[model samples]
Target: MGGSGAGGTNTGKRPNGQLGSWFLRSGWSKGELARQVNRRARQMGAHHISTDTSRVRRWLDGEQPREPIPRILSELFSERLGAVVAVEELGLRSAHQSPSVSGVDLPWAGPQTVALISEFSRSDLMLARRGFLGTSLALAAGPALVEPMQRWLVPTSAGGQEQPEDEPVATPSRASRLSGPELDLLESTTAMFRLWDAQCGGGLRRKAVVGQLHEVTDLLQEPQPEATSRRLFRCAAELAELAGWMSYDVGLQPNAQKYFVLALHAAKEAGDKPLGSYILSSMSRQMIHLGRPDDALELIHLAQYGSRDCATPRTQAMLYAMEARAYANMGQPSKTKRAVRMAEDTFSDAGVDGEVEPDWIRFFSEAELNGENAHSYRDLAYVAGRSPAYASLAEPVMRRAVDLFAEDTDHQRSYALNLIGLATVHLLKREPEQSTALAEKALKVAESVRSERVNTRLRKTLDTAARDFGDVAGVVDLTERLTAQLPESAEAV
Candidate 1:
């Protein structure tokens, strides 16, 4: 609730209650005004702004915004009122905008989104604090997710759009114009980064990935032909998606979500429906991990709806597999099975020859599908109270994934993850010896990678094994070995 005082009550106030008068005339509560300001700040890339009604109340009580916020509030009001609203008119003292600060507000236009990504990438790469990279912040972003989803689903026309007058525009460098060679370089760089992420995990090369994203951002400012620009946007989109995944790998969920949204916007600007769908799918995967299965389901369905007409069989298979995972998490066994079946059928229909899958989705091989199914079954088993039958069903697929992933160095993390899953299955079967052995092996492989996900999985495996078979000699030995070798943070139950 917001306090409302009539204009006549403070006609000759010293603080000049113009802001409050405007607030009352607009019929917006203090909380709503704070939300609007915070949102606008995000759009302007102010990463640390966390305003609430209390802050708004202070502003009404003659407390002024620190910096850049006054400018932001003026712009927000200007757009809403369809007239010029200067900083002085907002009854706030003007201050210099902060340098090197980036926020994660969703931009409506494609160009603005690109600029936002460019600035954020550069800031993320160089800034020490990286305050917006917190996993907890990302997990709590359900409300923030709605606006972007709506914008993607029902795009606004160019005519209805208004650019913030205070936004800093970058001048294009003549020497930085796009070329075929530059495009090739960007594409190759993206591929290299993807391989690095897959092989070594995101934490090991996250800074490098962010640096590369900054480079791409630099390229994005240059002028180019329409066709070349579109291709460049697609390439940049892929790189941004990889950067997002790398951020996720390092447990920087908020940063990951920002990059993912940037990638989505880039994909849309490029008119690459397949890439956009993949970006959405990636977002859904993150949501699923963050314990928002219903939100994850909506994003996955939106991807399917947008890409259904032109998505390749392999892409469709991947989307269905993701849906199955979401449903499994939601404890909807029937829907989970149905999505899994759809994925299987779609993959089966993907013939061996003359089928050109996008490079980004080429990872969805038979082994990947098997791994996805194994994960779904594992989730279902958990939902079923760790039933031995479901565990048994998961084991063979996990074994297959282990062997398949082992064949590719880029999939070492996946192989290790599958080993953890297999060990869990063994634990469910009360095979302490086998479980300890598999978990030990997984831990060894995980040690060579820098994935937080693999670390978390290994910790869970050891915890489960120790809880069930602490007295067993094999379990004791493995537990001691893990406690000595693993990080102190991960050694905790």
Candidate 2:
């Protein structure tokens, strides 16, 4: 909880000129400084620090405050300065201190955002472990979700600032104009990563996908024709979104949020409003899974507002379906059903005359919609007074999803998830035998994928089966077998 630096300790003999200088430059009175520090401390969940002008005077007189106060001061100055104001800069070094994450605070501008994401990718790649990125998922629900939504909604500068010109523009080369082949490679690679993630889960190849992101960053630095540049930005946005999805799947919610924010910036640069809306929708989904249905609802509203005119029918259907999910989580069956109907109607309209849909939304087919509906029904069954009718409704839809996924082997992870959903429905229906059989099949399929989401779902299903029918031999045997297959951490869950 101490600061970091190589500064000599003043024995409270003379005034600390550095502290006084920063304090003056910050344009805050001593009392105001103390009050701001106390407020920020409380927000960070630190022990309350009673402060006053007298305490500030003592600091100015070369009397260093106790542990944690220096760190708090560093943070406050950093925020005010719009730059990293280290404890060392504040001349408040201490011997015993806890470590802190190397924070990145980028402005919500165009090229700066690109630099921020590039630096983030490099830092993330170099770190041997997740470090601060491994923090709890609950931490992702607050500003991480709100900031991106707000930034996306706000207009930047007039004339719509162009993306950064390729570096070293004085020299003309192939790097000055991105060729068709480079764009195609990027698009195909993104598609391949998406497919692999759907089939095998993100845990297996997440780092490799991130490595591709590093390559994309290099491409972003190169110049291109106006059309090619737009396409490149769009491609970068899609790849970043995929990285976010993989990060979420592997239980790295905070890292996932970073990737999503980057995707939003790239989408905006590309002038792809619908793609930006889709990224917001994805963020909403993550919020919903984190049990913040209200936040998720707000994000969906933003997505709808931003893309009301531009989003195609297919994308609109997907957004409405997400809205249904948020409402279902909030236990508003009436609103949920309304949203679902809207989604269904829009989807039907999109199908007329074999109308082509955006490639990004091609995965939201009837089967995907059915699966989404089944999940909504399942959530309603649990939260809406445990309505048996909803449970009954979920079963057949989930069955259809399972059957659909079974036919498409490339979505084995999703197929396993559907099986888990169906098994839960059976358990709700009090059919222990069917539940046990379905749970076993799900576990077997899930074993092939390295998804924390699938593992978590399987654990939940097993927990449900054990609670309802622990004494039944079939249920007990199935649970034990599944437990044996899972990692120790997941098995414990």
Candidate 3:
């Protein structure tokens, strides 16, 4: 595959003094150079690339690499040297250089969600913003999440999920009504989309989910009888939440926040307290991702309080576990342990009394709960100033999560993430080789999944390795794979 610029013919190898000079200046080994180039290309949406040390050696010997490779190389050099290193600066002709890589505000409006829903749906359906993307999206804080959570809590308030019984309900006669079959189709389709999302992560089929969300939101614009409204809004809530999740997986934190608000609003309209709480839990997860454990804790508390009366055992387990994660990240061992026990107890009682759970909430199975709690322990081990007690405790729990993920084949994203968690546990165990091995396994699974969050986490683990293991060979090799990734992922939300 090594050749001249895209569609250009390869000439005989001539010594590339220009590339060699920069190579010396940059100080990376050839293998390291190839790995970094491959990583940068993947970020640029070229995952099929396989640039090896041999490829880099050839490039230095003057076999001009393919179009994007030379451009990618130039960018890497620029960043490394802190200057605008052009393609030609790397001794490659820029005649056919690849081009450089380059928000919808649908607010809740009007008396009810009709105008808001209609506007969001139409705009989203018509929206097509797919281009080469490299985002620095901050997960929203303050009013972004707080206002939505408040609205969810007070269902009797304006634009609240449920219409107050004391008020006259408007069931518009001219509204386009959904038939039972149509409603069922939407429900089934949403479920199908969710299954695909579970297996593939947030990057794949994201547009399809947004499309489904649009349809549901559009239907929500038409006024309907109370029963009809409940069903329609429930579908909208589920779809919107799924869309938010997909966006979150792809690292579009701000966009994910908007979708989460839409889901919360839809749940408020349906008066589906449990579902609304679920959405809050998701927001809380986002907070944790953003390193705002305090915010994460607050969000979970709100969700728990709002759903206290009616949450199914599984739902309670999920929320409690989410709370545990927040506490773990905060280095609050006692509180984290307390919350974990609650999660375990609630999870044990999930189906004991024949309580029916929403199909969506049913996903919080033993494996999922195990994975969540494992993450909590892992965080306590590392995030809590490297507490050895928790570090010792994390390995076994994390291993169990990995085993469970292996048993559950359908949850590919979860499986991949749990593998990462286990690898982290190995990292904490001071077993650098073991950690590298486990991380390699995790990364392989991550390749089939399109979630940028997974890739980000992989980078984080490697960064940790670089800090902790110093000159360890395996750690060095793993670290070089993405050393140039994500300075902007740290931008404040």
Candidate 4:
């Protein structure tokens, strides 16, 4: 995709050790970096730019690439490194980097947190207008989050821990405060947004979610009564977390990571350790989806350990399930099974009614756990040099997940995933007839949802079906339909 055409002038000819270090850590060859940058540039509508490996060499040799190139490379590496890598972090010293794109780092406990949420939400709106979802810039992951997570675990700020709901936090300013009833409305609105996200998918309501989240950030700048303030932060945390999930659904990894951090900060402000832990687990899920299970383990372990005293048993179960997913992705079946067992044991200890807890985690029921378990087994089944036993093991679990997931709009994505998973299981068993038929049903269900995650799984299943049953009429029909109708790039951003 690179061209040997006219481009930015090389600013220097010195050895750029900084860029070299990052290029090495990026796990990309020079040509690959050029290719990925070109693709990312095309996504941003810079169609004329055709960068090649020679240009990359010049960059590594301390040549300052022109405008947009620095920014593009920053976005690419940010996602690749699973951290918010600024241009400077990449040894890119171009003066053209936009301040809006570069200012991703935010303080954890301060007024600036409010500022970031406001600016981030507006920028999200701008990105939507530019044919992008959530954020295409300013995302961070893993090590970039270490300090913030540490802050969350042992907060230094006063009134940072759980307090009586009605108790006013120390040094409450006399700024205009939002009413408790008004905050209640905000909370209810957030719940409604969550339902819409699950039913219709993330792309449908991102702008609205970002807008409401921005409004909440504005409210946070002013002082409210203790109860109202905690409620406001709780609402903001929920909305921000939803925004992050929606971003993830659309395959915008950077956007998701940025919003997840915002949500975690808000959760901490609300003295909600459980919610903070949930946000960390969400970040871990993103890492797993992006195939960085090492990073996933780091986040999952942090979530499990940091919230040990505060997280409910169901929450613990969710964290352990995330742990299992990471290990399964690494093809470590033993550790994966151990984590799943721990998840099951902890979940069982949640008391038959699931121990009255936060509304957000109510979905971690038998069906959800079964879905996670099936996913672990499915991952193991596909691992290199694995035996067929895992494939057979996943079938019943996948079937149960399909049966348990309600046939309603609310559980549309999960239902479709189960169908696809079962189809994959059949494909692995070499049963083309059943696999293709089930895949057809999944394709129909997925057509109604707008999740790239769902699309990614469907693509993988179809690819397997094509490879294993290319001659089967049903597989041919399914493949034809998918090829003709869907062109979504399923790779995680």
Candidate 5:
């Protein structure tokens, strides 16, 4: 693969200037160059690249390499040469980068263009494993929102039809009004995800659900009528929102934010303000989880303001309660209490109608208030250094969230944190055994959820208990497990 024989093809010109400059300046042997390349490749996390003398000679003599190998070679040489080396300089520009979900040609693309989707997906997977919340936020809903809304407002097709793949095979239940192919597809997908969420956890199922939602989005894009099409689109949006929420739960904040925005677009087209509100609320919750309490507060306000007329009293109550949590986190106790009162007022108003809440919103009952307060107080406790009242509220509130969202890894993790909070209280009160037992119980639930935050907090509590209560074996063991999972930079390790 060398450029030519010793006497041929501009041999006296000493290869391309870029190649010649490197060789002459370094006065390196072919074999020595090969070794350098191999070392560089290893440092770059690359495996194969023959890196033999012959290959190095060919590369120096202006021979192009193949595909990814060429890119790696260029990168290696650039590092060694102390300059940027283009693929063309190595005569390997033709071997293009592989096409991902992004940087692709597609007719119908949403706000998460291919580039955004691919980056978001990889980011999600990485964040899930590392148990770190990604700090990316959603793009503003400007042109992205307007274009989709305008398109949906215009008539594209005469009638809506369901995909044959989505057809219902089983008889519909009396209580389950969901029928036909689209509804069947929706129910099945929801059930499948629900089960995965229980068994493997949301972190495991998030990608699959996101992919499915994208497929559903494509299917719903076909031209259809106003009413039926809108309903189908709304359902797809709901699924997308769920996928986003679960993704957020698993620490894929950037992707979750984009998906939520996409869900908002779909919901807007469907004229489903309530669903849009729910999506907004989900986004707000994610913001809070990421420790951006101010951003979360803004989102909650948006949700409450946008769905004032469309949302049911139950939904309103849920929104108010969420805002209360945000307010509490900000340490604005009066504002938090006001928000809680509003939620209570909404709930009381809804009680008169006795209207059933949506299945998705079923977890938002007054009985779940304890869990909400627990979460708020937990955040407050973290910010305030230490607060007895916050600790007191967190324990019972977390206990209730545990009971309600039990089997839910996310909630169970929250419950575990609450237990730790309670344990901290016990420790402050000089109760060693109670603290150790509570810490153990919290860790047990924590074992179920794939949460770095939960593990980190657990370690903090365990370490404190272990130091203060050195005789406690259980606390020591829990501390060890927590330490094992954390990076050395994290506390307790």
Candidate 6:
């Protein structure tokens, strides 16, 4: 119990109970415990917990904790008890799980879903850290809702029809200036996010920054003059596309797909056909991730038609490469090779004049070509695994890719994966020392990024090592630890 104050007046008796018992065991005073609990609670916006002795006494006396307070209690008590003390044990069952919102699940969803998704997305950082297993995306909210709508807007009816050769593009120069704080803010934020995306990954940044997207969209919707407004609209369209990309990074596929569609709509409204095509390409990439290669192929073809002349050569090359990857995924070797050839041509053409190229296209270089080919070969190698024939392309392509993306900014994950891929190939080819060396390099790189994707792929390489190199004691133990730390996606990949 808390004793008298400085003047010897009775401050208040600390209630004797669970919080007190834990505090005694931990040798922390009520004031100290309260300070820590309140600090963490304030960070999470649950301000009900007070540092006052009376309230801490009530908790110690076995009084039930309220929402969020229980979580704080759990944290405080866990430290006291020298082990985890669940909120349920503290009589705060209400705080067992994080709060859930219904509608904000989708960025491009209607008001309700948007709010729900935003809330959930924001909470994911803490939830993930706490090891709370999230529910899988509900089946009803799958691609069914948006796919039909997408097909309707970009109907296949005129899919084969080409725009006239005489079609002219409207180019707005400095004379047609765009002026506004919103545009400036959008540009500033976009560049900042892009830089962060390369370093820490889109996953790490998306959860925190996506909330600002709504405000940006709102600003773009405000009334403005025609020319400036068009520019604002285009900027908004790009923002939406970026929002979609970030969504995919955090494993929210359906929500991301919806944002891509919304970006496409915004691009069309801004009369930016090339931007719309880019969004479609992004959507196709998501489709490939979802194992819908057929859909991905069709979307890439649509992008090719829509962006034939409007898009820069670099974007065209990227689309072709992605399409080739899709074909490789589908086991269509002939089409895959053909698409690869087209990708080469597009990249060569795009490299002709650096002066006219966009900043976004600068990453599309010879090194990037090596990286893309490596990924393509990896896809092919996976498909060939189920067949009788052994793979030949995976090792060489991965080797080239690792060399190419070595110096590329924020590509540490890819470099690690390429090394892992090389290791996997070496294991397949019965070169144990070579395989282990490459795997070690991959593990070092994986430690640098908070990427489950990199970790997961590395796990596959390690698992193979375990199976084939188990005879060696050192190899066996290393593989065991790597296998133990493997994430869920590791098995799937």
TM of each candidate vs. truth = 0.74, 0.74, 0.73, 0.82, 0.60, 0.63
Candidate 5's error at 461, in angstroms? 4.1
| Residue 113 CA displacement from its true place in model 5, Å | 9.6
User: What is the TM-score (0 to 1) of candidate 4?
Assistant: 0.82
lDDT of each: 0.72, 0.73, 0.72, 0.76, 0.57, 0.58
TM-score of 2: 0.74
Error of 3 at 455 (Å): 1.2
Q: Which candidate is the best by lDDT?
A: 4
lDDT of 6: 0.58
The number of clashing residue pairs in each candidate reads 4, 0, 2, 2, 3, 9
Candidate 6: worst 10 consecutive residues by lDDT? Answer: 2-11
Which residue segments of model 3 deviate by more than 4 Å? 1-114, 121-127, 130-139, 157-169, 173-176, 477-493
Lowest summed-lDDT stretch of 10 residues in model 1?
2-11
Q: What is the lDDT of residue 116 in candidate 1?
A: 77
> Candidate 5 vs. truth: CA RMSD?
13.0
Rank ordering of all candidates by TM-score, starting from the highest: 4, 2, 1, 3, 6, 5
What lDDT score goes with residue 395 in model 2? 83
Question: Which lDDT tens digits does candidate 6 get at residues 219-319?
Answer: 44344454564555566556666666765654444346555665665555466666777778787777666666777787777778777877888888988
Cα RMSD (Å) per model? Answer: 12.3, 11.9, 10.6, 4.8, 13.0, 13.1
Count of clashes in candidate 5: 3
Q: Mind giving the per-residue lDDT tens digits that candidate 4 earns over 1-493?
A: 2453315666667778888888899899998998887776666556667998888888888777766677677767766765556677777754633534443345555455667778778887776666544323544455665555665665545434544543434546465456557766888888888888778777678779989998988887777665666777888888889999988897777678788888887887787888988998998888777667877888888888878987889999999988998898889989999999999899897756646788788768778888898888887887744446888888898888888885545778888888888888888788889988888888887788777777777888888788877888888888889877665553222
**Model 3 C-alpha lDDT per residue in residues 1-493, reported as the tens digit of each score:** 5322222334746778988999999999998998887766555555557787777877787776655676677656754663445566677864431211002223333234545544554444444342322221223454544654664554363443455544534455554467889888888898888888888887778778877777666666566666677788888888888888887787555557667777777776677889999999998898787667887888899999988998988999999999999999888899999999999998898899997777788678788898898889889987777666786777777788888888887788888888888878877778889888888787778777777777777887888888989799888876765555334232111
Off by over 4 Å in 6: 1-182, 386-390, 427-432, 472-477, 481-493
- How many backbone collisions does model 1 have? 4
Backbone clashes (count) for model 3: 2
- Give Cα distance to truth, residue 253, candidate 3, Å: 0.7
Q: Which pairs in model 2 have colliding backbones? A: none
lDDT of 1 by residue, 168-206 (tens): 223333444666797788788788778877888877777
lDDT of 3: 0.72
Best by TM-score: 4
